[model samples]
Target: MADTIDEKTGTGRTEQIRDTSSSDRDFRLEEIDLNSNRDAKIKNPLAGIPHDALMRNVEDFAREREMTDLTDLLKKGAQIAQRPSEFETIEGLTDREREVLRDEVLHRWRQPKALYFTVILCSIGAAVQGWDQTGSNGANLSFPQEFGIPDTEFLDAAKTIPNPNFTHNLWLVGLINGAPYLASALLGCWISDPLNNFFGRRGVIFFSGIFCLLSVIGSGLSQNWWELFITRILLGIGMGSKASTIPIYAAENVPASIRGGLVMCWQLWTAFGIFLGFSANLAVQDVGRITWRLQLGSAFIPAIPLVIGIYYCPESPRWYMKKGMYRKAYNSYIRLRNDPVLAARDLYYVHAQLIEESHIIGKSSYLVRFVELFTIPRVRRATLASFTVMLAQQMCGINIIAFYSSSVFVQAGSSPRTALLASWGFGLVNFVFAFPAVWTIDTFGRRALLLFTFPNMAWTLLACGLCFYIPEDSKAHLGMIALFIFLFAAFYSPGEGPVPFTYSAEVFPLSHREVGMSWAVATCLFWAFVLSLTWPRMVAAMTPTGAFGFYAGLNVTALVMIFFWVPETKQRTLEELDYIFAVPTAKHMRYQANVAFPYFVQKYIVRNKNAKLEPLYQMDKNLAEGQARSASISEKP
Candidate 1:
């Protein structure tokens, strides 16, 4: 039998025993050095030892095997096994780090290059959202007049409606716009997983862009209201897919440090697109209703770039790893990182960690996965957080401003043309102020902004609502209301407008993120439908003042929820967030870590000190130990 050798030193030793008689076999063993280091070699004897003798020897050895040591060995073995997988993860990275040496590789990605591409691509999708949303706004304004209905006939038809008021109309319009959003939200949830599964994220995006273009054209060419509504529904489906998939694509592809910044670009582009649409409307206001068709039709320009530009974009490395296509994933990683070896190493690390933390949840059926979101506490919290944020977003009455600004201004005593121009100003303010949100979402964090701005928004709306209650012939009161309206838009664009979208994308884990965001967005759509359907009636009943006040109250409720529940997620890495929220105790504790919390409470909150700080520190330590172990193992051969 071959004798086992000690691995640390390539040395051999022999064990000898005396024979009692000639009949007794002579027991002699000589150690031979093996070319590799394996624990199994150290574990077994040359010949089978009796159970009693093995037990005796173990008792005499004095040192028992430790669970921690066993754990470390298992972890080390896993690290070694995954060394080849590191290459697969690099495809998810941006261009700046592609040139770095393996030894010098760091987790912080090169920002401008990777983030710039992410911003640019995601911006394309967001522009589509803005154009589609605002296109409808501009189209509706002209549709009433261009259809050749008398003003009295239009108002009479509107009055005959079940909810015959400004609030009811506002709510109804919200519902109409939200109908497509609802479909998009729900479809976005299911389509994201499979679309990503078969064609990859880039492919899904390319297809969605095509759909958006077609929908826009369909909307522009519609000769009737019903045709326009159907096209809008189609456009909603496209928007839903884009809304769900694009954020996941951007979030997964960027480095942890700048992920927030890149995702915020989606909002920035949305605002810019709305502004552009409004600008187009203002420029062509006197050029006849055909200009509205042109404005609505022009969304095709950006859709073309989105489809073509996405063709060159790489698939998410994480998705590639999940599918077990390691080699292809590796090649993609290399292309993305511009370094094969380093790509392999990072891919291996991510794969090993994924395997270690693997759960059965992700492999389940779609309905099962969807159900699990509500059943599991952490997932439930995440889902609710997303939903609540989106609900708050819609309830803030911003959509009423977007869809009914002309109506609201006319009620405020402005002429029809002046009201339309003021509506354009609202879009312009939305565009200009959105930049501050994009700039501060990462810096100020989600909860901070929410807490700070929501109350002000509520007050602004309340003041505007009160202004409506003022008697007519008060131009001074009207001036005050107009100033407050401008302030309302300014506050909303920088705060509520961007945060809902950003928060929905950030709070959920990657495994269920798409579905979670889909549901949240869907919730927005549902409420939008309710608000739109009822807004006209509410406005008719209470006029503009009472309608604005009702929404202001809802904003206050949203503020209370945000102050107590929302978390600060500005700089957390995906992995760190995963581990931080995995534990039941940690999950609830983290919800209170927002920067706006009291200092003493922030420090002393249960598990806040340990739970919040420990995972990130441990992640770093584990990653370091894993790298060291890999180096030791790789050095042997």
Candidate 2:
């Protein structure tokens, strides 16, 4: 094992790290070959340096960062990175350090309360996000007539009188319904980079929370449709920025072992917010004209905890390190991890990887980094994958239901009260089903869950659309519509619903995280804007069956795109993803078409006894090779 011990981790630090200094380096050093496959392995940056030299370098790192007090810990951590099994045997190691190291592995999920608290705070922010998106859903039924906006009666059985301005009014209602996403796409998401740069994750969330609170209050108080549309636009600033920052904040502080499941709280709680929004609609459904206002304004409740509680949560350790605040980063890491050794190990490993990234990606202005997202090979693949997930999210057609479910129910022939109640059922199923992903997302994994569920979502959504053709007079017609819609939500909750946000959050190098996420969120929200704006017209032109069928076809297209373009990221450290995205896209696509597809047919479809599937990516021990996404599903960690 290259004379290095790894009692818990698989194998020892590789000779590849040492060979970097040799004339005949196998992997090119000009840039990490962030090719298209997960099979490519990266040499550990900490692999080969001699103990004394490494200690000297560690000392230099500590001194330069004004963290000299941590020099000894840093040196030990480098030793752990270079040789983990020998961590128990490292020179001058205390019993407590050894015990803590063991605890880190055995109690992977037994995290510090502070860490879980931080995740909760981030989840609350997501709840605020979900509440914002859906508050207007129930309000959509009542608010149009109050503000003279066009109604959906022309498209469905529950038609209002044919007004002369029906076409213009329909477009106007769509415009208002879609304003938040338009504002988010055009303005709010793009600004997240600068905001995150200036305020850090916590501060950006606080800023967004205040905006969310104020905007919801403003929506409730608006006297006209235009005023309400403007308020929704203002709300998008909060929604977009919060969406960009919270998952990243949660990802940065958590351990990689459970990162997916924990980060998934964003989707889980957001579903809860949606459910609550629907419930609030029912609570005040009988309160007369002001009921719409209550539904629109009640979203401010979740934002209250978000703005007030952010200060109590620790800032991201990576953010502090990026800003050159090593001492503060260490403190934050300490609070976030259970033991000092664990914290030290993460801090130093992340520091080393960041240094490697600077050499690979090159540090520069935000614009330069933004440019590099496409210019750099590794970052570009990440950009492509991030874009795919975000775009597929809208393409899957989940938002059409989310943004307009009540109206959809009314069109399906339910009474207004029955429609609102049915929408609540949709919300409940969405929230309840998301719970499974909190476990499976880490086990079955992000890519697998998405792959498995997309087809189900497609068929179910198609079923919903087709059910629209059933005669409205039959009691079975309304029941079937509600059933298929809920089924669509069920399929959506565990896969597309959470994967996009979580996947986008972790795919980029820290240097480009803010801007990369902005691009991704913008892609998602922009398409969402398109869907919200065009659905009224599309449904008007295509009928519910045609509209739903079109998106179901889109869901299939999205599934194909995901299989070809999206890489699995389950169980990977944020820093470790550099290697995951390094393989060229051509290489990744070739593996899937030539190797993965063949293996799938042999193993799952053909049921061949001897067919074996080989992993495409190879990682050094320093990156925790065995704990990666390449591990077999039946294999224990």
Best by TM-score: 2
What value does the lDDT take at residue 324 in candidate 2? 62
TM-score of each: 0.72, 0.92
Candidate 1 contains a number of clashing pairs equal to 39
Give one digit per residue, the lDDT tens place, for model 2 in 1-637. Answer: 0122232463443221122222222222323444333457755656656676677677777776677888788778778866765676688678888777666566667889999999999989988888888888898888888987648663462345546777777778778878889988888887888898777899999989999999999999999988998999999998888888898899899988789999989999999999988998888999999989999999999999889999999999998777666688899999998777777888888877776676566556778877887888889999999999999999999888888898888888888899889999999999999999988998888989999999999999889988887888898999999999999999999999889999999999898898999889989999999998888778777788899999999999999999999989997789878888887888788889999999999989999989998877766764554343224323446
Per-residue accuracy of model 1 over 43-65 as CA lDDT, tens digit each: 11112233233223223221221
Question: For each candidate, what is the lDDT?
Answer: 0.60, 0.83
Give the clash count for model 2.
16
lDDT of 2 at 206: 93
Model 2 lDDT, residue 141, Cα: 87
Using lDDT, give the best candidate's number.
2
Error of 1 at 519 (Å): 1.8
